[model samples]
Target: MTDHNQAIRDDIAFMRSLAEAGRQAPLKGGSILMAAGLIYAACAFATWFAASYPVSPLFMPTLWFGGTGLFFVALFALRRRMGAKTETNRAAGLIWAGAGWALFVIVLSLMLMGYRANGWWIMAAICPIVLATYGAAWTVAGILTQAGWMRGVGFGAFAMALVCAWYGLEVRTLFLIYGVSLLGLVALPGYLAMRQAQRAAA
Candidate 1:
């Protein structure tokens, strides 16, 4: 009986240590997310301005493509600076990366469909989809970290998606609102993550 109790205690202690280590692991790739949010925010703003005030036919697409390109460049640079990742960070990174790829494929497909359909009404759906994707990502992160604030942010993102859809009839309004949403949903959380990582390193 004594030996069995000791074994059970050792197993519990081992699980506790694993949980503690996971809690302490700092999430990396915040800078990449922050840069993506800021870059796309600028793109959305520029596209809004172009729509409000007429610009060259090629201007909006060019701006968006350039912004995406810039983000990739920034991603490469920031990723190189990152040190070795813990299992926690690796899991978080995979989730975000998958979300990013999903968004990329969805957005491009929408763009192509819009072009083929010869109607841009489909473009209005992009903001809501983007926000919802962010919501899912944040929700998963919250589950992994067991953080209430992250979960709140995730639910808040879902609400924001509905808000964007409500105002999505107008391209200009949608772009403006989405830019703000990116600031709050993507940029702010990313900044907070960066701060947390910095403090952890310290």
Candidate 2:
């Protein structure tokens, strides 16, 4: 069988084991937050569409959008807090890796200023550098929690980075699309899938 099919089977087996062990408790918190993200995306798109004005995804929206993601992160922590355990070390690895990326962002913002020749170049680099750092975190987190779905997300991020380099979009446009599309599109769904998988295992 192809590796993809094998991986799916393994994931299924893991879920079955969880179910058999009665660890499966539905995590509605993650689901509710994801649904909220979709709702917000729909509202944003509609608002932008009706107004005939492009909405710049700004800092406030980022805080709200990022807060939604943080909600899921809390769900993961809560699950573990409530006695959930990962058979693989991937979860722990991913957590530490996430921390690494957060630190990288702080450092990068401080250091990269004035280092790059053009302001647009700096903007383009931000997405990829952040995402690559994030991928590095997932890589260190352990392989089980780090799956192909995440690889795809990383690639999406890398693609965004390339686009940033090629097109040099305004920071506002980049923020809007990245938050509404990348996080909303890639990170949010990946988070939901993880939660769903955990739920099924329960």
User: What TM-score would each prediction reach against the true structure?
Assistant: 0.88, 0.47
Model 1 clashing-pair count: 0
Which stretches of model 2 miss by more than 4 angstroms? Answer: 1-82, 90-108, 111-124, 136-146, 184-186
- Worst 10 contiguous positions by lDDT, candidate 2: 21-30
Record all residue pairs in model 2 with backbone atoms less than 3 Å apart, i.e. clashing. 24-202, 93-141, 94-141
How does candidate 1 fare on TM-score? 0.88
Give each model's clash number.
0, 3
Tell me, by TM-score, which candidate is best.
1
Error of 1 at 51 (Å): 1.6
Deviation of model 2 at 38, angstroms = 9.2
lDDT of 1 by residue, 89-177 (tens): 77778999999999999989988998999977887888999999999988877666656677787898899999989988888888999
What lDDT does the true structure give each of the candidates?
Answer: 0.84, 0.48
lDDT, candidate 2, at 98: 57
Model 2 agreement with the true structure over 83-154: per-residue lDDT tens digits = 444444334434544554584575456346735654533544544454455454433322334345544654
TM-score of 2: 0.47
